[model samples]
Target chain A: MSELIRDFARLPQTWFETPIAAIALTLAAYFVGVRLFKLMRHPSWFPPVVIAALLIAAVIALLPIGVEDYNRGAAWLTLLLGPATVALAVPLYQQLPQIRALWRPILMTLPLSATLAACYALLIAWAMGAPPEVLASLAPKSVTSPIALSLTEELGGSTALLMGALMVTGITAIFGVEWLSRWLKIRDPRLIGLALGINGHALGTVRAFEISHQAGAFASLGMSLTGAFTAVVLPVVWHLFV
Target chain B: MSIMRGLLWLLAFLLLGQSMVQLLPIPLPAGVVGMLLLTLWFVRRGKMNADVVAVSHPLIAMLALLIMPGVVEIFFVAGRYADQAGAILTALLVGTLLSVASSLWLMRRYMPPLNETDHE
Candidate 1:
């Protein structure tokens, strides 16, 4: 058969079309990203997640496989996000001591910080003439990726757009937290880490860990609570008005 | 804690959370609800099960890879974002900075400085 006889470079499209291939490729790319991240000594701006996405993009560009085809395998991974999100309880549990210790500050800071995070993003985007869909995508910008992606889906926002906003938010929060904390003269690692977590989510948590174990603990707490709070409250509030 | 047992526990909780969403009038996603319930479970026990931790560790760690499909959606939807990238970037930058500032201010201004030894 001509198909079996084809040269390596001229392989059939169907050979690249299997779900196993798609999953394998995705895993391989992500593995490559992790290796690269470690090799580079773990730069903040160049996360393995971002790197893997770019690699996947290159593969897509070079091949005839479209998103629909790739997603046949990836859809299972996406579905896994639900349980993965549920698994956020582990970090929250691990931070229980720190959470109990500073319940007051955590509580006082939560409603305002979480509300402002959503409002500022939405309002600013709205003012800048971003359409309603764009606003939806941006509404959960401060949330961690899993929660944000699910919320964006509920609101009919583009998850792709939300991902971009997430990267920007994470990068901005990482850079801005240092300057902001210095200006506020807040020497408390707990508060600084909480601010970082609430605004920046997982990336912020990683950065917080770099600051100190205490900061890292509080950051995980902050990231988890903000995620749950925004996820629960945003949908209710979103439906009420828009 | 074998991985199988750990996953079973996680899935059971996940089921509980999803059921709550369907039974109640909450607009929140099942995953968020599940996360809350599981936290509460951990609180009640005042400690974590090794099994749950075992399963959750990998799931959370692999999260970056899990969400890659969503990010790649940009390849298809770039047309929608082509005109507004600047506004979006500016909004994210300013919004994130202001958020960090306000949260830090609120905590420092309102939260009485508790000595580190107080919690013990």
Candidate 2:
């Protein structure tokens, strides 16, 4: 078995062998997450991302597996991100007519939402005594993954750490969004999903899908707009604070 | 058309990623720059290819799950923040809450109802 494993690792095929394990783990995590999510009545409190993270963390700790091995398979999973992001256009296109009707409100609110969120981050960081790197990393949490990772590295934060934190934040929001809405008695799926995506980031977007199509569309739009708004404004805010 | 459109957006997102790493003048994260670029494109074009959107949506979804591999790194940071956990955690909790609350409020105020036309 050890010799077989060695030979398979040595195979000239990085693609097939490397990502297979990660894919399997991811699928396992997904299956578990789905069950838990369903059992929980699909509330936002049971965010799949967070559950998956915790589960994966536990598995790695107990199994004696290396990240390199995990990543060998995980890397293939990363390839799906670009295509999945592109898929967001489908719901957006369907919602186009409604989006157009509500254009004024969206245009007016999105920037303000972005600014307020960034400002809050700045304020909290200022109050918290967080180091510069943490501040920089926290600054871009609302954006998508690829962009968020790049910003983390650029801003002198640990890209890996920031990525992890962003994932946590997104997942927490995704899981919590519905519960928050129900607790608050907020019924608008569009508002709930958009708010989650904007504040929760990618994790929120995933949660958005679990709800309804209209809600998912709004979440995607919010995610995109917030990213743009924060990209333009976060640095400016950082310059002022840091 | 489908393949070309997907490729274009993919290349564009990739370029945006590059720009975040390079062209952006801010002290912000590069990934944020790419996101900003994508958002700008959507805003300007007012439409994106359905195929492209389909392709990109899942990647973002997967990102949430992808974070598990980095837990070892988080354990390392836990030490650094340990001394300041009381403060930092407070700040994180507060900041995150405030950001979410305000963002939702503003989004609700500014965003037109979803049932409205897409041209807005």
Residues B1-120, candidate 1, lDDT per residue (tens digit)?
477787887788889988997998765567767887998998998888888888887887676677666677576667778899877877888888888888888888776675863656
lDDT of 1 by residue, A1-242 (tens): 66656665455257555667777878999999889989999876677777887888889778866777777767766787778777878877776776777787678879889999988878788899988889889999989886788899989898788887887787788778887778777788878788888998877776786687677667767887788789889988899888
Q: Provide the lDDT at B5 for model 2.
A: 70
Calculate DockQ per candidate and list them: 0.60, 0.31
Tens digit of per-residue lDDT, candidate 2, span A8-127: 765534433556766787778867976886788865554655576567656655554655566566767766555456445556766766666767777877777666655666567667
Please state the CAPRI-style docking class of candidate 2.
acceptable
Best by lDDT: 1
What does the lDDT come to for candidate 1? 0.79
Return the interface RMSD of the candidates, in order shown, one decimal each.
Answer: 2.6, 4.4
